[model samples]
Target: MRTYQTLTVETAGRVAIVTFRRADQLNAMNRLMQGEITESFESLSGDASIGAIVVTGEGRGFMAGADIKEYAAQTGPEFDIFQAAGMRMYAAIENNRKPVIAAVNGFALGGGMELVLCCDLVIANQFAKLGLPEIKLGLIPGGGGTQRSVAKLGRSRANFLLMTGAIVPASEFVAAGLVNEIVEVDRLMPRALELAEMIAAEPAAAIEGLKALTAHAVSGDLDDGLTMERDILGELYRSEIGQQRVKEFAGRSTTKAKKGGP
Candidate 1:
């Protein structure tokens, strides 16, 4: 387990739960938090002991956005560094071998929505609000919010929310395909943990390979994607876990046949 000024990480078995600790700011991300989170995920990606990661907010919201006050104070190199850090952090979250799930506990706007977009899965509080409201401030979502919104919600709906800076309730976004599930506030973490546990229960190599293969299929040609899938399938089929499962399946089939014959 590790602790940052803005986040806390605790591993329960194979699932690591990372909680944004700055609830007073609605877990608003600061440059420091961005750097720390990037570091955390980078570390987790290489760690064999941790199979999955869950991100959630404390108090009332997942993350309101970037720390606006801090963002407003940046200039020149500082601003460039901040924005670059955000890009790296978001990419690390999205590309990590271990699955990352966003458990949005409250408000998810602007950078928050961008962060959620990077996640492989999202489970949020039923009453949570999510959007890219950066437009109202005369700035687009510089943290990849604009691109992610379009990718996840499609162009028309993304334009409606991003252009209007509308912050709708979680249910609306769920209907639009951004969120996976919505639960009561009390159920948010439990459900997220449950989902993470399910992912962690799978063989680690297969889980990581599946994520890699799916990501490739998104942008690769069908022939290339099928080639990659076949390669991964061949690799996994020879792995210890895969072989063990195949042996168990054969034993069960033999036992069933013997019982039926006798």
Candidate 2:
């Protein structure tokens, strides 16, 4: 229920919508904003009422990247501390128990794009542009931009983007499997909520298991991944909620058969 200087939180049913409210500065990640983001996700994880969280920016941009002016004035320790905090925000979202969706409504560059890369799912607007333009500023993304970007988009594609600092359309991200879908500007939040709601409809145990197993699957080898998946699948199959849903589904199937439906 608490509000932060850089964020606005609104709950729609079981979904928490966290929007970047720093519109005047194009929602750039400053020290306060990054800490707020990490804290928000940490708090939301403890709220059982909120099943999922959607992160987006206010106004015409998701985030124009970190506030460049602030970055220009940082001393050695200041920059290191800020960078660590920013990484924590990104990691919090990436490793959060709840599913975090990125509803990218505008340009996401540099740190902005890195934030998107850390999210569990991304629903981007058609006109949105995403890139890691840190190289253009005589820097490189220090916040998982190299590793996470490569994990999602593969080495060659991620390499080209990072090397050239190219800002490309959302379509290219979809092609690279980075984005889940593209939507019209007006439909962005609605579609993201639709997906969030659908995910929330499932049993929490099943969803949690999936998130854990998938993370393990991606990070570990195939043999270990398969074993972990098998363990989760078996447990979920025997869970009370799972059995209840199966019974209801069976009843519906039986009724449909009696009615001569497919």
Candidate 3:
């Protein structure tokens, strides 16, 4: 297990579970929290023992937003620096090689919403609410929310939400394809961990390459994206992780049993 200043990481089987602490403040992102997140994510990315990652909040909510008190106290240059750091943290998550699943347990607004958007998959609790509500504070979702919502949903819906700055229920996000699944609050972590374990069971290299390929293909130039995919896949096939997955699958009786299970 690895400990972070603002988060906790625990490993089970090949999955790394990362939980955002600061439940009292709903895990709001302050400067310290942002720094911890960035470092933790970077470390997790390079940790060979971790095959998959899960991100979740520690208590009643996933995250409310940026720490309003901290934001309010920032001056012009200070605010710019703060926002930049937060944006970089989100970008790190988006570019991570290992698949990361977000387990949204409750309110996920503003920065919280942005955090989930960076994940490869998002599983929100039924009681959870997600939104960009930054407009309400005369601000905007600065951490890829504008681009992600538009790309994931559509221009019209994204525009509506940003303009209105409304909070949408978890089911609404699911309907709009923002969230992968919605489970009861009690089941949120289990569902997320299940997903991580499933990914961990797959060929690690393939999982990493698949995530990078899909993200790059959708977010970058197609020709360059395909080339990157091909290169990564070639390297993956030659790695031990790929060989182990192939051997494990080959011995499985597909007709009688599945590749992996509960």
Candidate 4:
């Protein structure tokens, strides 16, 4: 809800569409931009009216990466401050209660790719190019890309892409399981919203529980993850919304099994 110089949030139905508004800079992640992102996700996560979120860039690029000019001259503490801000934002997206979708329209590199990886689902334009090329800059992806990418795409491919500084096409991204779907640039946002709306239709409690379950499974002990999932799912099933939906589904199944007409 707060005004952001580098970001914009628009509500469509139950979905909150968050756009990185710095197309002029190819949507680079500067300190101010990163701060806005952190604030945006934090605000959206607690808003009851918002059931889902779609993050995208304003124009040609999703995000080119970190602002190189700013990075070129940085004291050690300043560097830490920069990395911390970005990490905070990406982590917020990963742990958001509602589903988060990335509609990557164009170049998504380095920190940009890390941002995409934080999403629950990724939908990119066919022309969108994604990579983590920080090694080429004598740097590394400090925005959680190292962990997230390998978890999603396996260690070999993660190493190849990050080390070689390869820029992969959207098709390759889909094949690698990095992105869920790819479409024309004009259709990217529509597809993202479609997915978001579908997710939003489900009970919020179940959605949040599943999100936590998957994230925990990815980063925690398997036994603990499974236990938490079982407990949370049971709680969801007992909730009023979940019970109503289950009853509705049962009624439909019963009607289908019955021979008599209504």
Question: Which candidate should be chosen as best, given TM-score against the real structure?
Answer: 4
Show where candidate 1 strays beyond 4 Å.
257-262
Top candidate (lDDT): 4
In order, what is each prediction's RMSD in angstroms?
A: 1.9, 1.4, 3.9, 1.6
Model 3 / residue 10 / CA error / Å = 1.6
Per-residue lDDT of 199-255 in model 1, one digit per residue for the tens?
999999899998988777655688988898899999889988899999999999999
Whole-model Cα lDDT per candidate? 0.88, 0.90, 0.86, 0.90
Error of 2 at 259 (Å): 4.9
Clashes of each: 0, 0, 0, 0
Worst 10 residues of 3 by lDDT: 253-262
Task: Please estimate how well model 3 matches the true structure, expressed as its whole-model Cα lDDT.
Answer: 0.86
TM-scores for candidates 1 onward, in order: 0.95, 0.95, 0.89, 0.96
The TM-score obtained by model 4 is 0.96
lDDT of 4 by residue, 166-221 (tens): 99986797887779998997899999999999999888888888898888887799
* Shift in Å, residue 14, candidate 1: 0.9
lDDT of 2 at 225: 83
Candidate 3 ranges beyond 4 A from true positions = 236-262
- How many Å off is the CA of 5 in candidate 1? 1.0
Error of 3 at 9 (Å): 1.6
| Candidate 1, residue 257: how far the Cα is off, in Å | 4.2
Ranking by TM-score: 4, 2, 1, 3
